[model samples]
Target: MAYSEKVIEHYTNPRNVGSFAKGEDNVGTGVVGAPECGDVMKLQLKINPENGVIEDAKFKTFGCGSAIASSSYVTELVKGKHIEEAMTIKNTVIVKELNLPPVKIHCSVLAEDAIKAAITDWKSHQTPASAQEPRKAQES
Candidate 1:
């Protein structure tokens, strides 16, 4: 299938296409695969702990042009966004922005899932006291 100009552009020059050092405390890494299509995606994010802003994002995807474009676009989209704001970015938005055809929509979904997985990993790494203190205060 033909790709949209945006997809072609992103695929041609994929952004943030590398990984952080292994065991980097500030970095969160997410890896996901599509068994049916044999696609694998690895996404990494570095976040500012104090304010929860995404400082950097990187992705390596093994799939079609749409998957690569989706991963690249998502990295651009999340950089500088607060974690909560980034979480609000839906797969449908990626699909629309990239002009992905219906058959290629799963690629966008994978991108969204990768983002969430990375964020979850980041959260998991945080100290429980630091991570839960704000929530406890809010509950009070």
Candidate 2:
């Protein structure tokens, strides 16, 4: 099977490939694996709590060229996007961008899952806005 130029470009020179600190308050992480192909992907995001925008994104993928490209592409897509916007991203976008064949479509799906999982993990760490307000002193 031949790979598209975009796929080759990303596979050879993938971007945003690294990890944030394990427990940073603003960092969210997602790790997902594909059983059929034995591909594992880890995606992370550093979010700005004030505005819910992703400040940075990073990913590590262990699989074929398509999987790596998909992971690499999604990292770029999510950065600077709101968490809700990131959640709406679908695997089809990755497939189209990388020109992945039908068989490799699952790779894009894995990338999509990674994004949702990371967002979910981030939400888990957040408290309701009302809970953060300072308490006033009671009248004596």
Best by lDDT: 2
Give the per-residue lDDT digits (tens) of candidate 1, residues 25-94.
Answer: 6777889888868889999999998999999999999999999999999999999999999888899999
Please give the CA lDDT of all the candidate structures. Answer: 0.90, 0.91
Which run of 10 residues does model 2 get worst, by summed lDDT? 131-140
| Residue 73 Cα positional deviation in candidate 1, in Å, after optimal superposition | 0.3
Q: TM-score, each model?
A: 0.89, 0.90
lDDT of 2 by residue, 32-140 (tens): 9999999999999999989999999999999999999999999999999999999999999999999999999999999999999999877766767522432221101
Off-target runs (Cα >4 Å) in candidate 1 are 128-140
User: Positional deviation of 48 in candidate 1, in angstroms?
Assistant: 0.6
Top TM-score model: 2
Which run of 10 residues does model 1 get worst, by summed lDDT?
131-140
TM-score of 2: 0.90
